[model samples]
Target: MLNFVEYTTQSALRNAGMRSVISFGIALLFFAATLVSFQVTDASAQSACFERTALMKHLSGKFEEAPVAAGLAANGSVLEVFSSPDGVTWTIVLTQPNGATCVMASGESWMGMKKPKKDKVS
Candidate 1:
């Protein structure tokens, strides 16, 4: 009787151990899948069309103030638009966080109008 009980207990423990390991493996697989999905989404999001109308339409009303450099300078992995001194032409560029600059689009006769300031009531 004693030997039978010991054998049964050992078998149960072994089975429980196997179950734990399998559960851990499944959890790890799920975690890896989530990471891969995020990476793919991130890569796709970073991609740009490099077309004029597409870029202009996407970047409309999203322009931010950027500083002028001697030749050309950009920072961050975001789309940016720089215009000529007369504001008649515009150049769209993508600057990566690693300091890489890619000219996405450029056009002549580009004009942007500033929004009218709202009168404040004191």
Candidate 2:
């Protein structure tokens, strides 16, 4: 049973013709769920969600990723970005109010913004 968000997410991805990317995301989520069941105590591990620590550890270990940025959404959910050292891989995660964490998205070739140089006084 797909929730509204899930249904719409899939529909949007499919409509955008991101079939391969969507397939990869689904596979990653399933794999994460499988690993989480063994690593986390959360009974809801069947839904590709788990404790933040467990899921983060898996992501960090698998992809060598570390948190780079985060912010609170209007709904109170915290969104975080984890990126690999080489900037070749990244994942966006959402932590719900109930403490459940799930991968919202993942991809490769992620680059961060560059800081502007300061002007010298003449």
Regions more than 4 Å wrong, model 1: 47-122
The weakest ten consecutive residues by lDDT in model 2 span 41-50
Model 1 clash count equals: 0
Model 2 Cα lDDT, one tens digit per residue, 18-59:
877788899999999999877776653445677899988998
The whole-model lDDT of each prediction reads 0.65, 0.89
Q: lDDT at 2 for candidate 2?
A: 100
lDDT per residue (tens digit) for residues 48-89 in model 1: 444544544544434422323323344436666676565556
TM-score of 1: 0.39
Q: Model 2, residue 116: displacement in angstroms? A: 5.8
Native-referenced Cα lDDT, model 2: 0.89
